[model samples]
Target: MLFLKNPQEAHLQCLTFKKEGKSIGFVPTMGALHEGHLSLVRRAKEENDVVVCSIFVNPTQFNDPTDLAKYPRTLEADRRLLESVGCDLLFAPQEQEMYPAPPVLRFSFGHLEQVMEGAHRPGHFNGVALVVSKLFHIVQPNKAYFGQKDYQQYLIIRQLVADLSFPVEVVPCPIVREADGLAMSSRNRRLTPAQRREAVILHQTLQEAKQRLLNGVSVEEVKKWVASVFAPLQKKDIRLEYFEVADGYTLSAVKDIHRHKEVVLCIAAYVGEVRLIDNVLLFS
Candidate 1:
């Protein structure tokens, strides 16, 4: 696999592919590579002639400075994993290259940005949009792959593409999870052994919520059950940030389960200091 740190150089390399009438598949990630990330690369390789993967832990995306400092960075191991997955080019750029100065322009999703992760982490998706827009421009791939583990983020990026008219196809891949049903995440590296055991409960709660919602339980009752599931873990520092059941597309909160055709169960919580998120489509 070829690696280039400069965005200009990477764009030039991708341009060569375009000149040769080749298709490009892009996977943008903040590194600490795991099977979940490699899963996206493998799919990209299968679909496009040249696959470009980028590893830049964008500073703008993190609302907490400590959280930013704690994020794992294992570029060497990440590179080896990318190469093993048959990635054609790796565009790992420094923050300065991606953001020579503080970004002035902002992306506003309005109602789309007003719920869940957006409500918790202010200015988070704007930063996400900035980085994704930059990488989309720098790589200019035919298609870009994103995991559904970040279901809300997936929606925001799709809006970014449609609103701004980025000439790239946005592809949504399924959330790759552990055998125990814990969704794979870069933040999973920070979980203590005990916290790791506790983290699986997020998925478990979502599974239970889905069944309850399907079984004619009221929306309020399901929410109550989910809250009770985590009430006993207070001493463990496992706190539920938010539990939302909403339309799968618009993300509007579902007041009545019977009224919605397609809805999802989204949950966020802290397994100790590590914040984790997971979701399931209650019905489609």
Candidate 2:
């Protein structure tokens, strides 16, 4: 349960572990730990000799300044959760440690970065790519674990690793949900009791959409039906950003959902001021 804050310390520790021929697994996260995050850690522990978890709420990844400010930070609790999950090391670096000055290099993934979450958040995936690339470099593990909840992020990270030859395996774990079916998220803490209740609709909408698609509904009709389910909430205080059906790997709008190898129903909207995202994968 060693906590290493500086790059020099972590780098030395990782080098020593590598010298001993221990396989390293990395789980990068922004704190306020939840069960979903622990799932990744557990997977890493099972498959690798050393599990390294990073807790840095990267400032570069936020499109909304206020949203960044509101993001949760529960470091002490996160440490305890990581220890409970049998994490070998935790790298909780400060902003200055990561970047003493603003970053100059930017990664552009073309169409992959322009659709879905990228289109909605604008510069969001770039920020994600940058921070993830940085963390991947810092950890330099044999394998890195990520949750399937952020399917697009997983895809982009895979692409990043492939394109850059990062020399690490990217493993995606399944999404962990609440008893009521709401996808687990650190942002779930921000939801009011009432908002939390309505948040369940996000998963319900995804489920109904999945059922519709399975019943042989067209892509257009599937989109319309899913939209109709959320019609009631659209007029409410909640800000409905986008409800879309996109190619799971390509992240483009599905013209013929029936022909697609795989499709993911992705949604992003504000339940009050807490912006939440959830997706379900449909295989053809």
Candidate 3:
């Protein structure tokens, strides 16, 4: 697999592939390969003639300085994983290469940024929009792949494509989970063995919440039930940041699950300083 660090060089390479009538599939990631990430790459390989994966832990996306510092970087292992999945090219750019100077542009997704991650992580989606727009320009792929674990992000990028008139298809893949049902994450590496065991509670709580919502429970009651599950985890160093059940499309907090065609349960919490987010979609 060819690795290109320069954006111009990567653009030129993709241009050549475009001239050859090859459809490019791009998977953008922060380096630290995991099963969830690989699932995107594998799907890209199946659907497109060329698969391009970029590994750049974007500094701009982190709202907290310490979170950026603690974010994992396993480039060598990431490269091996990409190769194992038959990735055609890897555009692993440095910070300077991606942002030669500070970015001046900011993006707003209206209400999409008002709740969940956006409300909690100020300037988080703006940074996400900045880096993703830059990467979309650099790669110029026919289609881009993102996982549903970050369902809000998937929605933001979809809006980004439509608003900016980018001719790229945004594909959302299903979430990949561990055998124990914990959603796979690069940050899973940061969890201690004990924290790791407790992490399963995040998914378990979501599953139980899902059943309760289906069994004619009120949205508010369901949310309170979720809080009850996490309330005891405080002693174990697991703090719930937010647990929400909102419309899957508008992301507005749903008063009743039956009112919306689709609803999603999204949660963000810290399992001993390792912030983890997971969501489950329920269709009516």
Per-candidate TM-scores read 0.98, 0.97, 0.99
Model 2, 218-267: lDDT tens digits are: 87898787767767886665766788888888888886777778888988
lDDT of 1 at 236: 88
Summarize candidate 1's per-residue lDDT along 1-284 as a digit string, tens digits: 99999999999999999999999999999999999999999999999999999999999999999999999999999999999989999989998999998889988999888999999999999999999999988889999999999999999999999989999899999999999999999999899888898899999999988998788889999999999999999888999999999888899999887787889789999998899999998764
* Predicted structure 1, TM vs. truth: 0.98
| Index of the highest-lDDT prediction | 3
C-alpha lDDT of residue 215 in model 3:
93
Error of 2 at 2 (Å): 0.5
Weakest ten-residue segment in model 1 by summed lDDT: 256-265
TM-score, model 3 to reference: 0.99
| lDDT value for model 1 | 0.93
Q: How far does residue 56 in candidate 3 sit from its true spot (Å)?
A: 0.5
- lDDT against the true structure, per candidate, is 0.93, 0.88, 0.93
Candidates sorted by TM-score, best first: 3, 1, 2
